[model samples]
Target: MQERLNIVPFVSVDHMMKLVLATGVERFLIELAAYIEEDFRRWECFDKTPRIASHSAEGVIELMPTSDGEAYGFKYVNGHPKNTRFGRQTVTAFGVLADVGNGYPILLTEMTILTALRTAAMSAVAAKYLAPKGARTMAMIGNGAQSEFQAIAFKAILGVDKLRLYDIDPSATARCQKNLAGMGFEITACSSSQEAVEGAEIVTTVTADKQYATILTDNMVGPGIHINAVGGDCPGKTELHRDILLRSDIFVEYPPQTRIEGEIQQLDPDHPVTELWKVITGQVPGRSGGRQITLFDSVGFAIEDFSALRYVRDRLKETGLYEELDLLADPDEPRDLFGMILRAAKPTPVAATVGAL
Candidate 1:
């Protein structure tokens, strides 16, 4: 019989890069979105809760966890807008997938890249149900680390390739435009958010600032427009003005959490908002009319990450892009953790012979 070793498959940053490159980026997002949508279709069967967060002056650290009866997953992630000054990423993350039967982690991965990918995928999935049919133009309001990914996701999933990019820093916009060159996008670098949103069928706000800054004004949103609100994910951070939320039909991943961390926090606690899962499951309407505005108040959710991890696990055997990590204690005899440690402290027969020589 094969031994049950105390090891898990760990996908490091290097391995993640290889895996993503090995599988084309667009194809990965499309496939990952399918996993996310599938989970939402069965949303009733999983454990759901608001992400537990630790906030500070610098930024926020959060744990997003969820499980279907048979499998469990969680991600440890941080959002620090000031990290760029120190030559670091604004967000960094890692996640684990485990078996619910025994609670042993099956796969562990670096989610800094995965989070960006999943966040973009989640936005596209919401757009699938809520965005206007045949929407092709998107206003990318923030050109930070997540902007390019958002653009690629929309293109891959929704066929949105006309991008109007904007940022407080022109350099960020330049960087975003340069990165996406020849990616089949009709690109425009706009001077202001108002200019960026002009004639756009969909708008995505993905800034990384950790404050209550309104990136979108009421006048910027128009009829038949879909807003992918991605940045206001913490208690005091927001992107769109409260007036905008009042006019739009809002959808979210989890309401208990969105009320505290999403754009809906600007509205009354009891204000009505539909869960995106419900729309995917066809329990409610998505776009009631071509003249009505829709908002996907997306704060990253555990279930989406759970789906992303599951997709990565499914691809491991075919890709061979992960490293095995000995991260658990599996004793030959049950309840023999101490004995296992003692056994490790002793030298092997070959080591003893080498010492004798």
Candidate 2:
């Protein structure tokens, strides 16, 4: 049997929780934002695609995969709004980082909370390019698991102070308010989406339902507002009225993926939209005037997950916070895959030598 050496380290959810607490969520958001922008700047260096999804009556599950010519990664995440009723998180996610050179996994960990952080970070990155200068006071249309992260992201990255919150579920709004209370944000619980959106410079939507629900109509939106559409990340799930998309200058992470999942799903396939990476890379323009409306259709692309995975891996290395896992057998002969496991249990040497006819 061929023997090989591999390194795979894993960090549990508890370690991740400790990492966030030690580094601070704001710092994590800032670092993630920087990494995402850095990766987006080199758009052609990565292999990108839309995520694969499996739908069911309760909710939907997804697999996001991407590669940067050298390294590959993927995440498994589920969105079930009803799960919270049973004391389970509405979303449960796990991801793996792998070496594309040898097609072997290097690390795997839970990403339920990590996904929320990355989604918020991505939204903030788009807002940094598209939102007006000195933009603060955001209106959050849906207050669920994502609301607190969105609030903190905007607050830290964009200097937003005031947040007007609205959600169909009163408990969800209350939960968001309670989580964000100690963070020094000026939170206002609005009775409706329209009330929440009134006079706000940035409007963020992160509802969890798995259907087409109009959280923001065109008439409710005013001029010069930057919309961060977060929850409408799957096919047939949308949050904005079609008219709002028709009136705004739409921006997206990846056009090919966003076309099938973002708020622009309501627009014609031929409708014009700007890729946010182009703006970050100076290949395109962002907001040109204070009177212009900007929309960021964030569908949580695989490249963002790629960036997040790399960031987490690096952090674990820096802090020495991971455990080594024996996921794959390293057989010295790369071609002798079958003998590696068999010999591990029984220390018998293989009979056939490689290339011995």
What's the lDDT for candidate 2? 0.86
Global fold similarity of model 2 (TM-score): 0.92
lDDT of each: 0.92, 0.86
Measured over all alpha carbons after superposition, the RMSD of each candidate to the real structure, in angstroms, is 3.1, 4.1
lDDT of 1 at 213: 91
- Alpha-carbon error at 80 in model 1, in Å? 1.6
Candidate 2 residue pairs in clash (backbone atoms < 3 Å): 2-331, 2-332, 2-333, 3-331, 3-332, 4-330
- Candidate 1, pairs of clashing residues: none
User: Per-residue lDDT of 165-227 in model 1, one digit per residue for the tens?
Assistant: 999999999999999998999999999999999989999999988889999999888999999
- Among these predicted structures, which one has the highest TM-score? 1
Residue 20 alpha-carbon offset, candidate 2, angstroms: 0.8
Q: Residue 44 CA error for candidate 2 (Å)? A: 1.4
Best by lDDT: 1
Candidate 1 vs. true structure, TM-score: 0.96
Worst 10 residues of 1 by lDDT: 348-357
